[model samples]
Target: MGEPSHEATTAPQEDLSSEATTTARGNHAEELTGAAAMFANDRASQHLGITVDDHGPGWAQCSMTITDIMANGHEITHGGYIFLFADTTFAMACNYPGSTTVASGGDIDFLKPTYVGDTLVARGKEIVKQGRSGIYDIEVTRGEEIVAVYRGRSRTLPARKPTTSDAAAPPVPTSP
Candidate 1:
């Protein structure tokens, strides 16, 4: 197979650009709603240069280019980075506007070694969601080649009543 290009191979540039625009605009208007809003404050994913390409009610797609910093002693991309990518995608899929969902557990199977400069796209889809629990499947790909598959279990946290301290504290201001 040919080497994967640095450009996204799954979604077209126009589509990805449009989605990015929508996310940016949404951030300005809502600032604290939906998966896009949740991702806005995600320092870890942002630090790793992971971008959320698309997301909706039950699915999300994100991409990250493997950098030299991500490489292990043997020079291949480390497994933790791949897992983090997939886990972030899974988080985007299961979270909604009003709820906070966290990964209960996840497991990944690496199918191939990933090298520095390789751009990997992780697509996550909700397999099932019942009550407060959900199952998601994420596939990590380089071009059309599958590199890893991750299965994630999620649990939506129960809404907690405001404590006396919370009631006494002033509301934190959100960024515009």
Candidate 2:
């Protein structure tokens, strides 16, 4: 009928959903773990008692227990502490072993108050990545209740010139 439609003549289309699935599976486990560990030792995070609980290619989780030092005059955890926890998670999620990522900008919304001895957990996930720019969202929670939310914009730096020491080191295995 009318010389077979062009749409019918085209080859079967590839599944678009598979592209997202494939990207999700691109996580390098070893690199993710190594990066999380390195971030755990950051001076500010360390000083604030932040610990990285998990991370992947575009996701991360970190936690901090509110101590006396983190409390404000009102006896509630300072907003800055909550923001730091979320920021650290965002940083860890955006960075990998060979590439450096920095925050171009970010903002936070404080939803609830956190008190001393409360353990706050911040989970960060990548919203999108196009070319060199990316967006991340972080949720800060105390137990089952959300305390704050943060949005961060990131830019990945160009590949660095490898030094002799770096060039000599073996690539970290993606699998355990």
Candidate 3:
């Protein structure tokens, strides 16, 4: 496994925080739209300490820290966690107001091993979006090095009337 380079002395968290604030200010009109709302209910991602750093109509960036619990038998960060981070970024990029997009398929390639204490950032961009179908590419990186790449295909579901079940379900909790 390749070790993380210590030459890059920049603080990843500070950079992400500033970027997130800038993105939010620039896209204030779309803030209450798709990705924000969907992420509010995304307990899985939240539980894993995944943070949606920035998101716009066709792009998103997310970050996560590899914890000891996420390590595999080989003592590296598990590939599935990387995939999930990429997939979450992809979902944020594709969905918009009035359209609920879902991943039809996805593929990921792991290029390097990550270990505990590493902060991984995944950036997703829309390669093409036509009608109800779209394609997105996500790149996961640790500091300045690329760790993984993901490609995802998405389909937007047609709008439907709310059913009784929808009304009966309880609201998703915002906190524990």
Candidate 4:
């Protein structure tokens, strides 16, 4: 309808070769315990309005409502939003009760169109976990119908410095 509700945005991948060596090895014993805590700094997920419905060892469920801002040129939900929803669930499933994990690569198939105001739920499950790598499958559904499927490959990052809730500390002072 109106110039494709929300245009998708992507960021360049970060190079952490140096920071990885130091932080990954130092904080092994202190990773966050829950999805909310572990992803408190996930601005991308937060900005997209995705919410965790449930999560536990090797499994996660998340949901998002397709707003006008999330529709594409055809007035249906954008494929990127669906992928983001699935990816978020995959991350939660892979990292529960473990160190940080990131998607190494992923693929998706769109099965049906989703419309504005539709509430889409994404469910993720670990298909396999070996050594430092894992495979996850995610299904995106609306009510009783399937909308998309996503498969992701994940690799656990070496534990990094512990993260704390920003609310737990005083705001850093800024120079006037």
Estimate every model's Cα lDDT from 0 to 1: 0.78, 0.71, 0.76, 0.72
Q: Model 3, range 82-160, lDDT digits (tens) per residue?
A: 9998998898888775467899999999999999999999888899999999999999999999999999999998975
The numbered model that scores best in TM-score is 1
- List the candidates ranked by TM-score, beginning with the highest: 1, 3, 4, 2
Candidate 4: tens digits of C-alpha lDDT, residues 1-176: 01211111121122323342233333332323435335444568867778766677677878888889989999998899899889988887887564668899999999999999999988888999998899999999999999999999999888655468534645543347
On lDDT, the stronger of 1 and 2 is: 1
Q: Put down candidate 1 lDDT per residue, 24-65, tens digits, no spaces.
A: 343232334546556755668878988877777678888999
**Cα deviation in Å at residue 137, candidate 2?**
0.5
Model 4 Cα shift for residue 138 (angstroms): 0.4
Clashing pairs in 1: none
Model 1, total clashes: 0
Q: When superposed on Cα atoms, how far off is each prediction in RMSD?
A: 8.0, 14.1, 10.1, 11.9
| Regions more than 4 Å wrong, model 4 | 1-31, 161-176
Clashes (N, CA, C under 3 Å) per candidate: 0, 0, 0, 1
TM-score for predicted model 3 compared with the true structure:
0.75
